[model samples]
Target: MDRKKFLKNGLLGLGTIVALPTAMNSCTKDDSIDATNDNATDGSNSSGSGDCTLSPSETAGPFPIKTPADLVRENIVGDRDGVAMLINITVQDQSEDCAPLAGVYVDLWHCDADGNYSEYGGTGMQSTNYTNVHFLRGRQTTDSNGQVSFISIFPGWYNGRAPHIHIEVLKTNGSSIRVTQIAFPKSICDTVYSTSAYKGTANMLNENDNVFSDSLEDNMADSVTGDTTNGYTLTKTIVV
Candidate 1:
């Protein structure tokens, strides 16, 4: 499918739509994998053993990256400040006995430490203006192991949503496969938010988030190991 058409179909197919509040502060409001046979935490198949099912499809907006092909890089931390984090995503083919699926492109983006997304802001929904800068956004292709890693700062939270990352998996031809969001563990969120860069408490938690509350078993990270002192690593597997 053409990228534009895919995005249009995705938006129209959503069962529920959450509205972002206008006049909200930039620091407020909201807001994987794999193949079968992988051991993932929280009963997911990322790091601990779990069922291999199709990852839940999610909405790609309020702010989806524009021209994602131009932002391909491993280090996506463009001037955003926060605790360093390494995001590792593995893609698997459920049809092939949960085997690794290599060469697919993964586009990932998230808000910075202030809860402000790049390429959007200075509006009623996001008070800070970041329209010209493209931070915290990048794309990379899965390797032979069907894994892609990104260097980013721990994301900050805003009102109405929890700290999360948005990812879209596409075939080499640019056709969309899955668009999903990943949730951070509350324990890790608490520790990351307490740091100087992300000083306030998150107004929303995974249990309270509209998108994650019901599908957290598959949406939440399999493991989030590390601390503010040494940075963190988030690993999850997505099966499609």
Candidate 2:
């Protein structure tokens, strides 16, 4: 669909699922954009499946594995100075079959409220100096099936954009390529998305939003219960 028309006609689901090997943004970023990283090894391009039937939902997770929430201390883990947002992810194959892909590492990164990042032990993210700390970001291997979870807060909106987070799925084995940036629901995202800056970039129509126009289900819809009003959840299948 044409850009203008597409924005207006956006996918129109509560969640925006992205296609494989999809990049959520065309807006070049300098924070950190390397498809290749230390945690991943399988760098080939393929859907995340391998005759495997294990799904993340079914797989045991490295963390306590809790539902996503935004309330203070509702779903808490990690250190007091640094709270992690837990993400429950699932991976699937082409046949629409689902399974837990274990030994896989999931990476996450998101801005804190007031729109700032915590660099290491810095005073959260508003400090003038960009510390080398990576708060609200972590990596954990999926258990037997394909389930991995995180403990974190609902990210605030920033610079004319929607409330969302950045993620990457990889073979904890350090080889498979990665998929990043799934979107959240507008209705639930109202508070953050309503912020002044987000409105400037809010998708007047889904089709108009450059990122939403081209995303895969794995990135957008991470779980079977895509209709939940809680925090974010989506699934992706990776192949090595």
Candidate 3:
């Protein structure tokens, strides 16, 4: 979708700042963890049925994480405040009958609770200045089950984009495999945004988002089971 040029032409000089909510000193224990969807099956494929398909390649958006190698940890929430979310991504190989592709590297990044990215802000695209901080960005290697999980806050929405998360898969040699995004269901998003930390609802929806409009439901996490009080768990399997 030529997202780079789109951001350069349409996002610059927007001069609109999304209101930031009060940040809590620390996330509550209940919200930070304890809500796990262990029985939720993988719903990342195009069809809801139990089958694997190659995840569509997507843009990294304008705010790609800087120095991902320096941010290797399971907990990506650094001083950000919102409903805690556990993102579980499973990587599979399409050539090998969608078997678990273990030992690969997964990089995941998303905006903070206030709809502001960590390392790139304080500019026309993002009004909040967070250049000095690194939050909601992390990299982890897949386990034997081809799964990598991150502890982060449920992301807040920006102007024209829906609530989503960016992910990049890399081989053992550090070469890129695919860049894609994870989408949240509208019901889940509405519920999360209604929380006190989120301040309000999103300005856009998944069907209307420029990136996810084109049959991107294949990347949507259908098994997001949890409440706003205890946090949520998003599980998706990406085939590459």
Off by over 4 Å in 1: 1-49
**Which residue runs of candidate 2 sit more than 4 Å off their true CA positions?**
1-86, 93-98, 120-130, 191-207, 216-219, 222-240
lDDT of each: 0.74, 0.38, 0.72
TM-scores for all candidates: the values are 0.79, 0.49, 0.79
Ordered by lDDT, highest first, the candidates read: 1, 3, 2
Q: What is the C-alpha RMSD of each candidate to the true structure, in Å?
A: 13.1, 13.5, 12.8
The 10-residue segment of model 1 with minimum total lDDT is 13-22
Worst 10 residues of 2 by lDDT: 56-65
Q: Please, what's the RMSD in Å of model 3?
A: 12.8
Candidate topping lDDT: 1
Residues 60-121, model 2: lDDT tens digits = 11111122122112122222222112345554433534434566666656665545544422
lDDT of 3 by residue, 1-240 (tens): 232342234223322121121222122232122221221223233322346667757778899888889999877777878876767688998878889999999999999878999998778999888998899999999988898777778899889898889999998788989888887777677788887788688888666666676644465663576667656667788888
Clashes of each: 18, 53, 0
**Candidate 2 — what's its lDDT?**
0.38
Give the Cα-based TM-score of candidate 2 against the true structure. Answer: 0.49
lDDT of 3: 0.72
Which tens-of-lDDT digit does each residue in 116-209 have in candidate 1?
A: 9999998999999999999899999998888887777789988898888998999989999888888876766877788788858899877667
